[model samples]
Target: MLQIGLDAGGTSTRATVVTTDGECVGYARSSGGNPISSGKIGASSAILDAIESALTRANATLSDVSVIVAAMAGGSADDSRDWLIEPLADRDFTGTVAWESDLLATYFSGTFSSFGYAIVSGTGAAVIRVEDGQIARTSDGLGWLLGDAGSGFWIGHNVALAVMSDIDGRGPSTALTPRLLEALGISTEGARVQGRSPALPRLITALYDMRPVQLAQFAPLAFSEPEDAVSRGILESAGSLLAHSVEAVHTENGPLVIGGSVLAQTGRLAETFAARLAAQGIEPAIVRVADGAVGSAVLALREAGVDITASVFRRVTDSVARMR
Candidate 1:
């Protein structure tokens, strides 16, 4: 029997199928699958389609799968599980089913066991404290309006605000002004805000209108030039904010696993994060979760009765090394 895992996020849904011996058999991808935001039908359809496609690629069927792990976002489990399972069951999936937050994918990607804390810095950010395979506590993640201070959204929103302030002569100019305007496809010189700027484009309006996830795209500006005061300030502030969140739920034991696009990269953010962790005196092992598929596969394989030895994880990691 095969093991299958699905890591569904707001941006995309990924499914992978592997054999009992940690051999990659199939993989599939699809668009955003956030059940909470996209509705149950949309989420389930995306997830099931990916799984079905993976099965087809592997020349296998639902019945061949011994376990199915689904890591997703949005809504109540009670609200979405039936919608998620009925279709799979209709296709004859009689395997053990597991449901979890997409964040768990980051955790599993970082560590084989369910121990350790995970700090997410992707579109939206959150710090999760995991104990014995279960989440113990969560810090921040209040979305863009309320919290998520150190997340991509936070950084991006700040960048946008800075740009607009500079345009209106309310804030000092930063290198991000031109780059941000260019990113938004805005041809108007951002400095025209003090003059006769007629009907500002939607790109300018996006500073107030774009969704939190969309705004998060600007986070890269803060990391572009680490030596710049604006960039350095944002990066260091992000590190400090994330460090505070880590302090809230950090445990004495277990490795500290840093996940998400922001912390995963080797830039100012990564360097400052390391410095902040050192300042906190957290000398535990630090791990990076480069791929969510690896973690999701590890979780499902274990449910399928595969031993989670280090060598096993290494094999699984190697199998999906080409994933991108």
Candidate 2:
């Protein structure tokens, strides 16, 4: 029987159909289907489209699949779970279904262990504790507006705030101001009251127009000159926050799994994260996941009655490598 795994993000959704023996039969991608990011109807539609596309590519139908595992973002557990389940049930699917956070899938895909702490530091940041393929608890990942304390957005947002502070003479001088202004392409437009107003107001307006993802582009700026005080402070704060986010979960000692651009990249942040976790008596295995899609597939295999032997895990890892 075929098994399906899905990774649903704010930007897109990917579906992979694999046989019980870990042979990849089909794979397809479609538009974003994250219910928290995309509205319910929109997310549901995209998810359905992606699944159907994968099945078609495999010369199969949903009925042929024995189980489906979905890793998704931007929806409550119960609500997002229904986003896929209710729709697939409508399509006459009668297989086992597992719904969980995309973070959990990433953690599973990154390592062979069944229990651990997975922390993500992309545009947003979060800590998830996984126990036997189920989420025990979580912290952070509240998005840019609310929390995401140690994420890329947090870094970039703080840099912007620092720039404004410097401009207003409320903070010490930093090299990031001119660099950021240039990156954002904020030029000296005609001033309010015929050039009487200072340039800071327009800069604030410019920052407003840019979206969260757009702002996230500047995250790497903090690492450009790691020795700079502002960059050092930001990175250190981020690392400390991440350490605390995981510590709050209090999971039994397991490999600390790290994901996302900030934590995965070779930089001061990653270094500091290791140190901070060590302070808590936690060490990490350093599994860098390029994409969490394959982990979803591995989970689907588990639900399809495949025994998770060491050899089986190897096969799952091998399938991901071959597909890549």
Highest-lDDT candidate: 2
Residue 281 in model 2: lDDT: 84
User: What are the per-residue Cα lDDT tens digits for candidate 2 across 1-324?
Assistant: 999888888788888888898777788888987876787789889988988988997899998998988887665644536756788899999988887578977887777677887888888999888887677898988889989988999988888887788777788777777778788776545655543335677787888888865677778778785888887888888888888888889656877667778887777787777788788887756677765677788778877878666666677778656654
Q: Give the TM-score of candidate 2.
A: 0.88
Q: In candidate 1, which residue pairs clash?
A: none
Q: Worst 10-residue stretch by lDDT in candidate 2?
A: 188-197
The models' CA-based lDDT, in order, is 0.78, 0.79
Runs with alpha carbons beyond 4 Å of true place in candidate 1: 187-204, 322-324
TM-score of each: 0.88, 0.88
**For model 1, where is the 10-residue window of minimal lDDT?**
190-199
Per-residue error for 107 in candidate 2, Å, reads 1.4
Q: What is the lDDT of residue 48 in candidate 1?
A: 85
The positional error of residue 69 in candidate 1, measured at the CA in angstroms, is 1.1
